[model samples]
Target: MGSLDVIARALWSALLLCVISFSSPLRAQPEPIELWHGRVKADQPFLDKLFKQFTAETGIPVHLRYIIFKNLKVELIGAAFSNAMPDAIIAPADFLGHYKELKLPAIPDSEMPDTIRPRFLKTVELDGKRYGYPFFYGNNLMMFYNKSLVETPATSWKELRVMKPYYDKRNIELITFSYQEMYWLVPVIGAYGGWPLEGKKPMLNTPAVISAFKFYKGLVDEKLVQSDCNLQCSLLKFEQGKAAFLIDGTWSYKRLEESIGDDLGVAVLPYIDGKPMRPMYSSHVLAFPDYESQGEKQTKLDKLRDFIFRKDVQRQFYDEIGQIPTHKELASLVEHTTDPNRKAHFHQLEHARMMPIEPEMSHVWQSLIRGWERYSMHGFSAEESAVYMQKTVEREIERDTQ
Candidate 1:
């Protein structure tokens, strides 16, 4: 009974303890939150600082994946089909409804802190459910002209047309495009008081739309602007001194700085008949996808959302990235802007109109692009283009409404 039995029993107890410890689950570290975003030159520094701060404070890691702008939609769709969606995505505002239709998780307004709600634009809401938080917002319809070329910028479309002869005489093309024509001709139509659709029906035959079309046709006919260049080409033309003015967004400041150097200038889009034409402004929004609908992940998302909208984070976003803060109070956070031309961009935010957030916006863009091609490429009259656009608009509205 003695020492042998005592030693055997002790050994058995040690063996049992080792088995229990080995079988137990290892303490797992929290998984890092994955964020998918579109290609942005300005966002890197802000995000790097943000991720460092987040990790230091909460021990929660963040991973970022930037997708090419043109490939984003297709990539998202492919991810959704394969059940490989990222935890969160920053997508274009117009594409929100499409994501919603795909059953992505909705970020309710109530989920956001009350302090952050008023800073966001109302257009971000759809069917009373807030989908995403606005990050970057601005119009591309505005033309930037070289002040040295045109001492006084034209105030309205009428003046622009009147000055065409002078510009042409100088052998300077007023505008250049990479493709066949401009993308958003909606502003021109609006300038002429043309509504593409009347109460969800096509109004292609309206007088206002026809007049707007004629205005663009006149510019083409006068050879003031080549119908051949697109956004990229237009920028190149302006940079090379081939053109004096070009229509583009605020995001182009960096590129212009590198290309045009000391000659860059900024101004709002020219008005039409003394009335300012409202142009579509694109925005990026942060959204939670459907796959993250439960458990510890949802709680982490809520915290991350709060972190993103914090004043310090928002300030960092604006200062480093050059994006306008959605928070009205933090609008002045971008004080580090060195270029005077860049500062001029901040003033245009108020007049900027949000792009259509409807699900059928894709269809509308397709139809609009085709209509522009017809008028600019072929000999179609403005009246014919207007009629065609009106029908397209009506069809889009009907498709979305259903």
Candidate 2:
């Protein structure tokens, strides 16, 4: 055991160790991509199965966290300030209103697939940049009636009033809806030739707005519509056949179908003064917060985005969850469906208007809700309430912008 021989043996061992380390680097495995959503527990099994397929195909893991729908924005802002944002979120189109606070990156046009329907594209695009990819659409309102009570659906508000006497004789209410909710009120405003927004500006104090308020009040005062009815009350009364007509969103279709079966009849919202009633429609979207800073993870998220738009994936969403796909090709198939209810939904969509996605819209909603409360409950004149809405929303917008 010469000293030179011992030194030579140590050198050989060190070289071999270096070669092994280089071949199999000690780099840590990446964490699973986190996605936040407000989907109900009933959707768990489907989402689990879908993500499982995604992971299997791409070798990337995903983790889903459910936040209550109402609190998602607040929680997201908290997470952002703490520098703990998730990889992505499945949010309603309104979430785009928080783009600046959340640092959500605009998805480049080239990255967006051509298959996305043009209408849905507008939901994600704010100003000149796109912020999200639409997953599914259809929050539009429609008219539903129990065919056993009403033989023919009315085509206009005047015609609907004509049926009140027939309904009175049968001891059935003519119609029921969420009279106090701004969402329902917005459509009536549209029917009266009013729109809440005119290219990012609020237009709440107009002749049409005052007329809409008066007309809505008249419906209650005349007993032409059920007063003091919330969504649940309306649904229950309609299901039990106490109410002959109901105005509800597309989301209620499955429940109504189950409750009334073959007796369920759906139609477009009735006209007001020869102009069609226009309901607001919106979509749930996939958004990436801090996307530009995702670094190495950006490529993986891109794959996930593209995967959601696959024809087979879109079809699965439609077939399983009854979500209308945002793909134009699939939407065309829905348009030609043989099912009567499906056809009715498409017809309603055709007549509906896209809801505004601007950040200012948040202020508008809050202001309108306050105005409606005063007009409907506090004995304020329709003109006064309309003026209050316009002034309140303007101040809120100015304050926030400054």
Model 1, 289-344: lDDT tens digits are: 77455467887777777787788777766555556666666654453466666565
Clashes of 1: 6
Question: Each candidate: what lDDT?
Answer: 0.68, 0.87
lDDT, candidate 2, 348-400, per-residue tens: 88888888889989898898888878998899999999999999999999999
Off by over 4 Å in 1: 1-30, 41-53, 117-119, 148-150, 161-172, 177-183, 195-205, 257-262, 291-294, 332-351, 392-402
Predicted candidate 1, C-alpha RMSD: 5.5
State in Å the error of residue 401, model 2. 1.4
Model 2 deviation from native, Cα RMSD in Å: 6.0
lDDT at position 94, candidate 1: 64
